[model samples]
Target chain A: MSKNLVEFNNISKFFGSVIALKDVTMHIKKGQIMCLLGDNGAGKSTLIKTLSGVHKPTRGEIIVEGKKTIFDSPRDALDLGIATVYQDLALVSLMSVTRNFFMGREPMKGFGPFKTFDVEKANNIASERMGQIGIDVRDPSQAVGTMSGGERQCLAISRAIYFGAKVLILDEPTSALGVHQASVVLKYIVKAATSGLGVILITHNVHHAYPVGNSFTILNRGKSMGTFEKKDLSREKLLGMMAGGEELDKLEVELKEIDRTLKN
Target chain B: MSVKSKSIQNKSKDERLRKVSRLKVLLNRPELGALGGSILVFIFFGIVAGDTGMFSAYGTINFLEVSANLGIIAVAAALLMIGGEFDLSVGSMIGFAGICIAIPAIYWGWPLWCSILFAFSMAVLVGYTNGILVVRTGLPSFIVTLAMLFILRGATLALTRLITGRTQVPGLRVLIENDPIAWIFSADAFKGLFSWLGSLGIIALRQDGTPLATGVPASVLWWIGMTIFATWLLMKTRYGNWIFASGGDKLGARNVGVPVGRVKISLFIGTAVAATIYACVQVLDAGSADTMRGFLKELEAIVAAVVGGCLLTGGYGSAIGAAFGALIFGTVSMGIYYTDVDTDWFKVFLGGMMLIAVIFNNYIRRRVTENK
Candidate 1:
């Protein structure tokens, strides 16, 4: 039996002459948090897109549950239990919590063509799942717009889990959240990982990633800085490396020179 | 993952979901404003023009006929608005579809039933084209359907003139005399029930032992049936959820695997089909089809939808609400003829009602989405 839930082996993607990802290898295992840390335009989005079946790699192969997979479309990826929750693309604010929880895949009742959406069953499941994650929903029928940003994030996450998501790819789930809400989401992330689901938390915030991450994969200009186990990496070292240590060193010197000119 | 037990127990695990109160549910309904407005209009007319036979069975049916004709279109418009689009071509489509039904059946000696089917098929084609254009070009439905409005209207006028040497096509009455399905669009339903009530004196009747209002208009029945069907689709079907999601956030809905494009396109077809039904009812009832029929009806449908609590920005509405909105419009417009008020004041009433309804809708939305 394979220990890894997903494996991206030497994957490279390009659009015309523009290389978005190059020689990137990453893996997610059962019950593990794999954080993908990168600056803006560091090929993080492209990598997530490739993994979620939005884009196929021009080179290399993707393996899911040790089986070689060809992601011809997003549906193919979803069928393989790969769910991606993009920031601001998770919930419809104008809809009820239950409706947003079961947007595309709705539970039906009755027989033949006289079928109906089972609102009672959906509300039960939605509220129960949300409650399991420590969010006591005030009302299952409440509009998602009335929920806090963190709770809405939880709803999206738990919804994915309920729908049989084996591997979760979250794109900057906490980037737009407040401190308290971000902490709430981080706690849920750990809870999700402990449930034996592989999670790939994508963000540039080292602080947000370091505490929850079991392993780190830093992306710099479409290239990998290699993966590191949490035990072997310190918070300070990870932060410096993620910010491009050598680039920051050169940038600090130029900033000091500008300060000297200002003093004159 | 014992998240509830193992997590630092700051929050209580015994917390249960709050029970939704009946009053809150009523207040939260999108149709509340329209429902209230309908009652107010009905009562006002009853008090002001009670002696004028405005509330008589016959007169009530008169205004209901007016309301039903508009309600059929308004309900479909509300769905499209909730799905985040508009069909400005609806009024023109009504006219075009009328000609499509009448010209063939009257001039070409085609069966009335075949002409009805032909008109509906043409509507589906136009709707498909409208949906395809909006989806492929990524243009605002307002602009796209606005162009459709002009093109359809011009085509109806030009084609009618070219074929008949005039802008009107008459003689549909003779064609429907022997048709099987034409009665479905006539004021011919509930004849037994209406006559029984007339005999019992529950309903006023004229000479010859016949009820003045012979039967419930098929238009009213169609309006109610379509409204109920739309409500069920919005609240009890997977496609209903898709409509809400597509209107609320297209990109977000698409990301979560909702077929947003298909939802929008289907909604366009729905509006076109509703317009064809409107045309069929009008042509059969009037015994004629004119290029000028249904002029500005598209805007009236939209106004009714908005008054029914549909958001202009999309994502929230109710079909029943739209029905009530049409009811109010029909009552006020028709009730004016029975009273001393000038008919011209109806336009002012319309604009005023629209602004007030929008304000009420805005308030309700804010109240529902309030921060805890």
Candidate 2:
């Protein structure tokens, strides 16, 4: 009975004869973690582009909160409370942490036609937001580029949460992270979900998602493999499906045969 | 239960604050140290000029006035640079705007305000053209604005000759002497206002009933006020953030739903408007507009921004720094005048200083960011 915050109803996308996404129907519930798994060229990027309003689907509609809406630009999607965090978060490396967090919506003080930057409030708010996300980053005045990759990702996520994003779309957030670092990012994803925001996690790593995801959608060559509830699928099945089980098995057998002949 | 929860929450908040302070320490790690060349120049100027009356209030005011003119242009130029573009035509635009005012005020007999308005509109139009061509056609701003620079310079020369029959456009005496507009363009407003306020000082209020007045030059006051405003815009406003983002990562800014095109256009307009404002002041002070005035001054403005700590690639600069950079240039120029040093040798010093500062800035960035 939970209403969908956003839904792609049979959307298709194509570049020349190559289909990027084919009749993909998927929905993100208001308060749940939805993971999209795929290898390279599995149309995951295409799907994200469509959802984040980077591109309009070649066919079908995007339904949001029981009403279908057409998003012409990313701002339109953002207005609907959908924030997309890319692999490389858009942050000025040299700018202070508070500046990066409040990039588009900075607070100003003072009266009349001449207003001043509310430095105290901005610094305080940035610090508070970072604390909420369990990032004990020292002064909000610190430069963003000084933070590690994982920490920057956390900052980006926290920024979205602070900006009142109803739905959070993460693009390969953990791809560049080490095991421990990825675990840190995964914790934040869970935290975001628990805070009552719909999280759409885009990643190729099934292991990273297995523990956190409530539902899964696998894509292959621009088409949806299926959408599965976490209880309905096993870890092995998901991996096998992603690696193309039969083909990987045949390749493994052939490699073994060659090794045995060489030994003989 | 409520009391316990509240105490626990307070404890957690305190813990969080401690952790955040630690992170702040990590982030404040210096990317670059203080600029060496700027310091050296200041020392050289001080040592050479300080021996005489060069360090006097009159000399200081003269230097500050020069800086004010340059700083005003440099601030907007820095904004454009931070937005990832450059305008080489700003200097020529200054000449053109002055000519616009001169022609209307003298020949057409228009009111001073009307002429000033016309000049400003012309500058805005030129800025719009630069923005449109650069953004719409996807041309490199360097090339487009460079072309604009030459075009405007040539046009200014030809027009001045055609209208005035000389290289200089004449007839701004009326505004300078009588018009109220002169107060804004030439008079030492900053000094006057501050003297008035300083005279009313409660701290200086003595039983003797004599209030001391502090004379702050109009140019210095203007520069300081503008610096404050520019700092606020860059640090606090949404538009200011857009400028930084667009300059830092134009594609990234666009990806994040920033109106990159609009931001660039506005900055272009701002730069031109600043030029026009400076032009009006310069013409009022001189009572004539020279076609060759401000030749290569655009480069100086850019140099000021770069020396002030703006990354040449875009993003990362402070308006205060740019103003400081202008101060360095202004002082060097006037300092040379006060000293026995020939003005011709000044260019060599300026060039060497610029080169050294760039190297130092780069080294600092590398040192701070490498480990991080």
Which 10-residue span in candidate 1 chain B carries the lowest summed lDDT? B4-13
- What's the CA error at residue A153 for candidate 1, in Å? 0.7
Indicate the residue-level lDDT of A11 in model 2: 90
Q: What is the interface RMSD of each candidate, in Å?
A: 2.1, 3.2
lDDT (tens digit, per residue) of candidate 1 on B274-356: 99999999999999999988899999999999999998988898999999999999999999999899999999999999999
- Report the number of the highest-DockQ candidate: 1
Clash pairs for candidate 1 = none
Which CAPRI category fits model 1? medium
Q: What DockQ, on C-alphas, does every prediction get?
A: 0.59, 0.33
Against the native chain B, what TM-score does each candidate's chain B reach?
0.94, 0.84
- Give the proportion of true interface contacts each model preserves, from 0 to 1: 0.70, 0.39
**Can you write out model 1's per-residue Cα lDDT over A16-107, one digit (the tens) per residue?**
99999999999999999999999989999999999999899999899999899999877788899999998885688879999999999999
Q: What is the lDDT of candidate 2?
A: 0.80
